[model samples]
Target: MNPRNNRQVRLRSRPNGIPQAEHFEIAQVPVEPLAPGQVLVRNEWLSVEPAMRGWVNAVANYSEPVAIGAVMRAFAAGRIVESTMPEWPVGTAVTGMFGWQDFAAIEPAAIQRRIVDEDLPISTALGVLGINGITAHYGLLEVGHPRAGETVVVSTAAGAVGSCVGQIAKLRGCRTVGITGGETKRRMCIDRFGYDAAVDYKAPDFEQRLAEALPGGVDVYFDNTAGAISDAVLARLNVGARVVICGTASVANWDPPPLGPRVERHLLTRRARMQGFVIFDHPEHTPIALEDLAGWVRAGRLHYVEEVLEGIDSAPDAIAGLYRGENLGKRLIRLA
Candidate 1:
């Protein structure tokens, strides 16, 4: 690899189920000169999210899948090293869809948000203050609409977005329940994330435990892992319950459309409202969500955790690790 080169993790092939390291190729390519109105960034941190699995899949989705031989798309935070735009001068800290690369030359329009809170860690721009936080804010408050004294349940409760959803729901005076994969995450959900109750989905008595936790029934169910865990949650929905469909982590693949217990009966019997939300569709809510999230952070009311991996090579395996429940919180890769 040349010293003056950009190292990037590109999509070598589409995966059948969960993506493997073989599906990605890390290559060193020459850094191109910045064009007019473009900024060159040295990415310090790259986000590894569950959504990346969908992005690499050949199946149709809300967004276009990453083409083979293209750089794997990702949200990254970095410092501007060179710039042709006055607004994005050298040393500006910014976050955007910069992909899994050590260096990126991006147009100003591609920049999503600038990291202005110097007091906070720059990585927070990719974690709590970034898409994860924003997604939780809108999905819970706007979509789920939990009222005081209501019971709110979140799947993947120890993960990035799910953790934030539980905390925010608690602030609204809702009884928050978290469903995670293992004992450690379950404990983290209750002890660290401040969920009223935490249940392990991997446990043999998961359904019984969930029933015991939500005695009053679930008023708001934030669905992150939509499979058997969701099936159990749907069965516990209160009349007029709100189901926020977020991520589908439990299902291994979407190509063949994995069959599960039908939800129409649950919705009809409970008079529930189920809606799917893609954060990208609601750009108008970003500023307000960020403002509220930042305020909560400053007041020490909101808490977050980040599990960072070192080097660009860690990007491929990092995604696999996320699905395997290896990451306790927000999984990130430090490229610099």
Candidate 2:
């Protein structure tokens, strides 16, 4: 097979608050031929997740930050173009840690999943059926442990993981409450995702509104935004409540006068437990979670949204968008 040229997005600088276009640099790269046990893949859709911010900063305990001059790390969906490995046939659809590049050279084993059918959009594998959905599933089920007839709350309620958390809670017969940034997102949480209720954090009386929505107290708090909203959720935690520490979108930008209040008192008063999870550590449960999520989507019990940008050139801005909350659902950059 002929070698192809690819484009890749690299981290140019680290941002202090919200990342800017200047932080990313785009460059053309030459794709190498697939060696034995390796495959050459062309990325179709690239996921820009909130965890990417943690990757950029080099801080998450489990994963280090993206070093300057390196191709930005990201999970992506793509089709194999050439493969010397029997396990991954050419033209096979797959998803994994493909990073922010138009084309990549990856070992067959590193390819997490092979597509069963092309009927489902490839992007779903990256968001709902991929890491995002798995994270929501395990985090909520194992950590949050939502019980029927109890109230379940999630922050960043309109984003990918938060959206899935709310829907799953609803399916389990829990009263689901979503905390989102604006009216549009609030409406989406209730109308689109079928949350029992939603609160707009941008509203003047958000705290009171959230309280009114969850009168029985929150049984499961699947926290995606760790700031005041989490504190507010903590205050409403039911006795023996379980809090899932998923993502901290609230403090992505390390600025003076940190946002949100201390929540230790709330945790103590409610006699609740809060736990943080890294999805990678639980690879054994991935297939089960993906099968469950895929079933939900097929049955129309779950819905997903994706903000897809075309080309690797837009990857930098796409990564920056997650911090500013510019895009909805799963933010991705599509490459041909």
lDDT of 2 by residue, 1-336 (tens): 223778888889976655668999988877876677789888888888777776777444468778899998888888988888776788899988888888889887778888774667888988888888899999988888888898888899899898999898888888888999888888989889998899998899988998889888888888887777777788787878888988778875654557566777777887889899999899998988988998999889899998888877787787567767787788878776
Candidate 2, residue 189: CA error in Å? 0.8
TM-scores for every predicted model: 0.98, 0.94
Candidate 2: how large is its RMSD? 2.1
Query: What's the lDDT for candidate 2?
Result: 0.83
Quantify all predictions' global Cα lDDT against the true fold: 0.93, 0.83
- Per residue, candidate 1 scores C-alpha lDDT tens digits across 93-165 of 9999999998889898889988898789999999899999999999999999999999999999999999999
Question: In model 1, where do residues sit more than 4 Å from their true spots?
Answer: 1-3
Specify the poorest-scoring 10-residue window by lDDT in model 1: 1-10
Prediction 1 TM-score vs. true: 0.98
- TM-score for candidate 2, please give it: 0.94
In model 1, pairs of residues that clash are none
